[model samples]
Target: MTTHITGTREEWLAARLELLNAEKELTRRSDELSRRRQELPWVRVDKEYKFETEEGSASLADLFRGRSQLLVYHFMFGPDYKAGCVSCSAIADGFNGIAVHLANHDVTLSAVSRASLAKLLAYRRRMGWTFPWASSGDGRFNFDFNVAFTEEQQREGAVEYNFQRAGHAMDATPVPLPVAQSAAMTGTDATTYSLDRPGLSAFVLEDGVVYHTYSAYARGLDGLWGMYQWLDRAPKGRNETGIWFRRHDEYDRR
Candidate 1:
């Protein structure tokens, strides 16, 4: 005897064909991303910043660590935070192998954060990550690049430049603008706070100078965010769900 099924063979086969179309679409899209990664639109770095590496203090350019192309994962561990964001934490989990292989292509990758060296080291040890993680604790590399929010930038309206707080308290609630009826709220305003974009940014070293290449945010980084997707995109999607939460047993919240 065979297990009963709901649909006809033709219907089942058609359904699978639809899934194949989706998978192929995603494959083409992924390949396009790979092409985009070949090289980024370059921008020259005008200001020099600093970071603390295991070797010791180094300039922003030095984070390249003698590599030609650099890709920095802006991990979200704020200056005062005790830990990194779980989303970012998950991404770092898959960075192990890529760390070694990317070097073969003259490309280098590192996780950059504002956490102090001691804190970064402790956390890296706990995560068992082998990638080179650096601390930009004393520098404005983060703030300048719009990846780390600083209290000063918030007050100065450098980011989240909302006008509602023109004369209001930073702690005061915002008064919705009457004009909002005509315009969709930008989710943030002049008075809103800026958390900076904690994602990926690339650079290339030319004539011994680092040039800002490109950056991405949110789902845009689904490609290199981890290896589970890369592995799942193979012949079979995956044996199990690819998501997990704080604990190894608990599933991550959708």
Candidate 2:
């Protein structure tokens, strides 16, 4: 009655054992990649970046909060959007529980966006998230980090994200379906929504100076999306088809 392959217990164990060996190898490779990420050179941050945080206006270094390291999630909440990106919101959900533990380990984790602090706070309350969310509305922090793009860049198809000239689909004559859908969810047009991209950046404060360590974007961020990790182990894997997720709260409404 099942469409999937059915196997005897003995056959299943043999196949699972083979998978376990491959899984172990993948784990070892992941560990090596992490080490290589740490080995990458840190670039000194000379520009003074400002952010509006819950406490008050704070500098990039101030974001460390007495910690030596900082991890910033470049959330896509442009000033014009009525709400945050649903994809980024899903990622932030995972951030809430781990932030306190990371703080205890001498690392500060925060989400930075181009939206106003007031808007961010209201949305944070809406989402019931306690993790620090800062607004980079007054500064070039998002742009300098290559997550926010200017109008000219978008118009000219000159936006560069994840270390390459990108956003072509977003700039197409007819916006891509998924991009348009995501934009609609945020109450923004496709171009306006695409102007702000999602990413993660790492920083370290050494001897009173902040240095950029590493950054990842696009599929590079898959590891950080908690649900995908679980889904990968599910019978149907990701089982995705054109924007299947919502802003945690939107699911119930559906």
Candidate 3:
């Protein structure tokens, strides 16, 4: 009852070899893109953004933690939400494993959210994550990075996200079913949950000044989602029809 094409071992090896060449070419292109990303002009960050960490209140520069480079995952955990975004949690599950390696290489990887430090810490403990998570509670850091929006922006029907003005789920009159479901999971309303979006931003500290290097949002974050990277190479690829993922802890219970 197998629906897939049946192939002999010899035929499969020949096709796989052909695919290997294409994969190698893609790897080379990815390397070139990495070089271009590094070449992008750096914008100086003068705003005095503050975040509440497990240690204490810290400024934006202090986020680097004495490292020259800082990579921040803009986790979607708004002040109103009781929990983090499921999709974001899925992405963050991989952070702990690579965080120490990045730190050893002089890069500090952290997650920043609008949730309170206590809330973040509670969720971090539940997930058993050791990586640094900071709360931008009542701070402009998330808004400045375009990862968090305001009620006014939502009512206006379009918000600048992923570097472009686009319609947000919060703007939907009835609120999309998926958004409602995700909001409920976060223990918030759709409008409130939609205010926070997922993104990653890079910053560098040079000569006692912090500089913005780059940022990526939405699908741009796919590369960092390890599960998707693995699924991409699977026989069926990412065969998703709807929101089928959950926070890692929720999976066993489901």
Identify the leading candidate in terms of TM-score: 2
TM-score for model 3? 0.94
Give candidate 1's root-mean-square deviation (CA, Å). 8.8
| Global lDDT of model 3 | 0.91
Clashes of each: 4, 0, 0
The candidate, 1 or 3, that scores higher on TM-score is 3
**Stretches > 4 Å off in candidate 3:** 167-174
TM-score of each: 0.71, 0.97, 0.94
Candidate 1 residue pairs in clash (backbone atoms < 3 Å): 161-190, 162-189, 162-190, 162-191
Rank by TM-score (best first): 2, 3, 1
Compose the digit string of candidate 3's lDDT tens values, residues 1-254. 98999899999999999999999999999999999999999999998998899889999988999999999999999999999998899999999999999999999999999999999999999999999999999889999999999889878856799888875554467878878888888999888898999999999999999999999998889999999999998989999865788888787763
Any runs in candidate 2 off by more than 4 Å, and if so which? 167-173
Task: Report lDDT (CA) for all predictions.
Answer: 0.68, 0.92, 0.91
The stretch of ten residues in a row with the least summed lDDT in candidate 3 is 166-175
Q: Provide C-alpha RMSD values for all models, in order.
A: 8.8, 1.4, 1.7
lDDT of 1 by residue, 1-254 (tens): 64655678999999899999999998999899778866666788989788999999888778877889899998867655555655577788878877888987888899898878888888888778879989988688876665666567566654431222323232333533322211112223323222434568889999988888877755566776555566676655545432333422235666
Pitting candidate 2 against candidate 3, the one with the higher lDDT is 2
Question: What would the per-residue lDDT of candidate 2 be over residues 30-101, giving only the tens digit for each residue?
Answer: 999999999999999999889999899999999999999999999999999999999999888999889999
List where candidate 1 sits over 4 angstroms from the true fold. Answer: 1-9, 33-40, 152-197, 227-244, 247-254
Residue 182 error, candidate 2, Å: 0.5
